[model samples]
Target: MTASKDGSSRNTLQSELAPRDMTVTEEDVEPELSEFTTPVSPLPATERQESICAWIWDGCSMLEQQLKKKAIKTRFAEVLESEDAVLAAVTLPKFKLRWLRTQDRKDKAKASLLAECRKLVLDQDQQAGTSTSTPTCHQSRDSAIEDEFFSFEDEDDTSSTAESEVTDYFKSGAQEIDSLNGFALIKKISLRYNAATPSSAPVERLFSLGKLVITPKRNRLSDQKFEKLLVLRYNHWFNS
Candidate 1:
């Protein structure tokens, strides 16, 4: 009977200790710990969308300021009619998926672009001490004055034809747009936005060059020498 009691006591201790050991082993497992681990994604969906939209708006404003064209305020509205058009033109599958996922807010993005362009124009006008009034807004008043001076009833028809030409230009396909040469302002805007570098490759290359130049052996090289070396290294064709 005492032996039976001893066996019962030992069995209970083993049962309790077995669970504690199993729990410890599970805690050590990396995959099991993943349940408690934080996510690896850089940003949540909503925050990521806002970040990308902000970047697009900032790029639009910067490009507009750089172009310094009078008609740039309406250029985005003319070309980027909606998100669908831009997405259709995209060739890469990855980019298309990304655009559909994050930049699906067509109306909001378009409005943001237009607002940024307008702000850019207003800033430029203020800087130049020119009137902040938009020229397109005063079109009717200007036309009334022009009609009195020129006194031509067919002027409206001519204006309509010119507007059609502009519309046709925007509706042009990628190949047609590439072939265009005379539309400098349109091409400038397209080139600025479309021809953007996808990566910081050139900048990264410069950093790599700096690392090579500033090694222990040449640690004392002056900034001027470093600059010269960088130019010569990048433009090695000139040396030959």
Candidate 2:
């Protein structure tokens, strides 16, 4: 009877230590792990929209800063403010018509444009040793007035022309400006200021072409030959 009791006790102990028929699913484990895991609450809709807008504004501001630096380096502001540039714009038929229509004081507008042109021509002549000195602004203004008097006389003779004919004359005048012989000094100054590129993209492209041509294998290429190769490669599309 004592031996039977010992076996029964062993069986009871084994039953207590045995693994149960149990399974742990993800759903069952998630709740327990969730207590230690911090919940990531999404931002409110309004806050998310504001954040997106701020990010966009920052990007735009960065671009604007970059463009401003480029403009300063290229003297874009100076060119825009230049009196010679104003004359150049006025010489163009489109801008000339716009100025005529916009300015209430027609004589003043014409005199100002003419004065700028006269000054530019005098400056150029002085640089070329053809003139002893540049005229003062007052002198330029006086000369412009005299020229405008003669120009007005000529205009008065053609005042009887139809409005359509006047428009046609202005349109045809564009060709004269394009020829660059009508206002050579003014055109030269205009071209000088306007020729500056806002970006160095073309120069960068040339450098990239040089890199492709002057590889490790062709490192011993002569400078002139490398330059020629770069040019030819860059202008290859022109041939097509």
Candidate 3:
């Protein structure tokens, strides 16, 4: 009985000496996401709502602007749909008119001549007022009117001459065409056309496929066959 009592006391002493399990409590352990969670700026309820609304409105405004820009780019309006309008814009007749107006020999010459005619008329009118004889006054007034008419006729002649020169310049051969102002104008227009982005990843991938298809072995493939093959390769439903 004493041995059993002693064994029990020893077992209790060993158990008391054994390491206890250290349980983690809420206060003892830090939250795993405590470092990641950022403290939000404190704001009044109404002010926070207003800020959120403003952010949403800003996003909507940006989306609307993008949609409007896309519409303008893709929409075929009445002006753009007209073949005559397209031709006129490309040929740039209005541009030619503005260009001619800046020339030293054309517009400047006409302006100076017109100014001289006005001065002459003003001088003659003043002389007619001062003249003693009635017939002399009438003759001066008639001559001034004739001079004004002649000046306008001269301007028309100059304009027709300029148009002829411009026509002849455009009709000239390869050497002359290279030196033309119209070539430079077309170059500027081409740059604007080339700046447009009307393609995406799918189109780019199609081009890569084209390079593969147009190899030395398949270089003789007809345009129709090439197009059909490309369409079939890209569209799974078509092949199925």
Candidate 4:
């Protein structure tokens, strides 16, 4: 009876010490797996869209700054505002009629324009002279000649004829005026001032050609040779 009681007590102790049946089910494991695998919520949809748009706008602004650096300089507009520009404009037949009308009324602008033309003519004669000795005499004579030549008579018939001439000059396809004939000095001045390019595209194109020619393999080329290569590259289309 004593052994039987002792065995029963030992079995009871073992049962208490042993772990309980703890088989995991899908329901128990799912929440744990989801906790690790699920992604954190991102910014709200509208906020995310706004951030993308802001990024694109910043990129565009950067690109615009880069392009502005390549734009042509606009200093030519300042040159067009000078007294010499008036003389240059007058060489065009379209402007000649307005100039004549201004001269007849003795407008200050016309006076300033005529003075500039006279100055340019005198300067040309002085440059052409073999000797610069006694510049005062030559200057006085030239001034008198210019004054008489440039003087306009306020005749209705003269005005009518000038208006007709201007109309006819444009009707003839506005061909290039003869540089050696009427208003040669003024024409030369016009060409000099108006020959500036409106944009730097041609210069930038040349730079691109230079880049293509001066690659790493040809980096040792001399300056003269590089220039020649650029010229050839630019004119390759002409050959084609």
Candidate 5:
């Protein structure tokens, strides 16, 4: 009994007298993540939203084509299946029209030509406005009269080109919003993840760093400790 007691005391003494550990740095002991963030933009809310919508258009177009290595096409409305996408697609075109009117063209002959075209359009619009006095019920009939008047005016000017372009654009836009006759099936085809700025690149990079940092030499870490370190590193990124 005394021998067992002495052996237990010696073991306790040896454990207590073991070499003291060197100080560990928070950085050396725990994983660290670099700072990354979204920058603040100075644009107005409407302008910002318009910019975002345009980017979405560019993204969706590329997603269906460049990323897939196929000749796929998709309408803005059907691609996202979200209310915001629909609103952005519709409102963005209207905003573009208003925004275009504010451009400052600085060519003499071109400016004069544009001025003449604008006058013709205004005059055509005025004639339609005056003819609307025929009758409220005959408004439908008056539209045919106005169309003829506008057609006559078109032959005398290059406004025909502008007007045709506008009509064609509107027609195409109408078709885009048509699912049955216009936009067809939008497949969620696989994108080239390795070839583009995927949404998960940032997360994947951090995970790769995690793999590198959690080495065999540091494999003694408990799961709870490792998780705490990850959370700390994540928070540290934003905090710093």
Candidate 6:
């Protein structure tokens, strides 16, 4: 049990709450305490769903703000298209099964991935005759080549006079949000994760070139033309 605190300053009492002290402390704490009861009555299933939907909206908003601060480089990308907020507008059924329960497995998978990535990076670096001078983010090219996983951010950077811009943004926004702690925590944790696939530009280009090759007006294209376009698209998509 956490200590009851002065809500304004949120300073906990140095002394334990004796019975007599409760009359002043507990009574004075009417509004905030009224909102937070230890034995909260269970809300109905529908009501609970509504509550969570609202929470997700706030979570998504916070995510957008954080991403803007990070300059994620693809703010208007189709896949990310305000989908976070939309998912939050309803009780997300998926998270209860997939994301929430898979952290341990994900962590294990990340470790394995990190190892493989290090080996691949180092092998390529050695072949090319280069090494890491410093590690950036969770892993860096040169350090891994020399068999070391290092982080770029120093102690001062981690906890400096100027906090991480993303951290400060969420700390300010999260309080206004309902039950967004998990979402915020996930974002912070995701900062260390940098596993990414190839560029979207090439993927888009392949699709563009494919569409051009197979004209929509041609309701029935010749087999040879279709095969040529398919092979060409795949070749460009992967070979790049």
lDDT of 3 by residue, 1-240 (tens): 999999999999999999998998876556856767787765777798999999999999999999997798578566554543443333343332233333553444334333433444445556876785455554677787888777866556545544554455335443432344644333333244334557697778788767756779888899999998777766753356
lDDT of 5 by residue, 67-170 (tens): 45433334433443443333233222233123222334213223333343355565766798788845466458778788878786555554655445333433
Clashes of each: 0, 0, 0, 0, 0, 1
**lDDT, each prediction:** 0.56, 0.64, 0.57, 0.62, 0.51, 0.49
Model 3: ten consecutive residues of lowest lDDT: 93-102
Worst 10 residues of 1 by lDDT: 89-98
Where model 3 places Cα greater than 4 Å from the true spot, the runs are 1-66, 73-76, 93-240
Per-candidate TM-scores read 0.22, 0.28, 0.20, 0.28, 0.19, 0.19
Task: State, as a TM-score between 0 and 1, how close model 1 is to the true structure.
Answer: 0.22
**Candidate maximizing lDDT:** 2
Off by over 4 Å in 5: 1-197, 211-217
Candidate 2 residue spans exceeding 4 A from truth = 1-74, 94-109, 114-225, 228-240
Global Cα lDDT for candidate 3: 0.57
- Per-residue lDDT of 209 in model 5: 55
Per-residue error (Å), model 5, residue 105: 37
Q: What tens digits encode model 1's per-residue C-alpha lDDT throughout 1-240?
A: 999999999999999878554355664798787879986775688798999999999999998887775456367665555543553333222232234334555445434333333444445445664555456654697686876699554445444444443345444544544443644333333455557568997788787767766779888899899999888776773356
- Report the candidate with higher lDDT, 2 versus 5: 2
Q: Is candidate 1 or candidate 5 better by TM-score?
A: 1
Clashing pairs in 5: none
Which residue pairs of candidate 3 clash? none
Report the lDDT tens digits of candidate 4 across residue range 109-182.
Answer: 44554444455655655576536644454468778788768756523434444444333433444435552144
Q: Candidate 1 vs. truth: CA RMSD?
A: 21.3
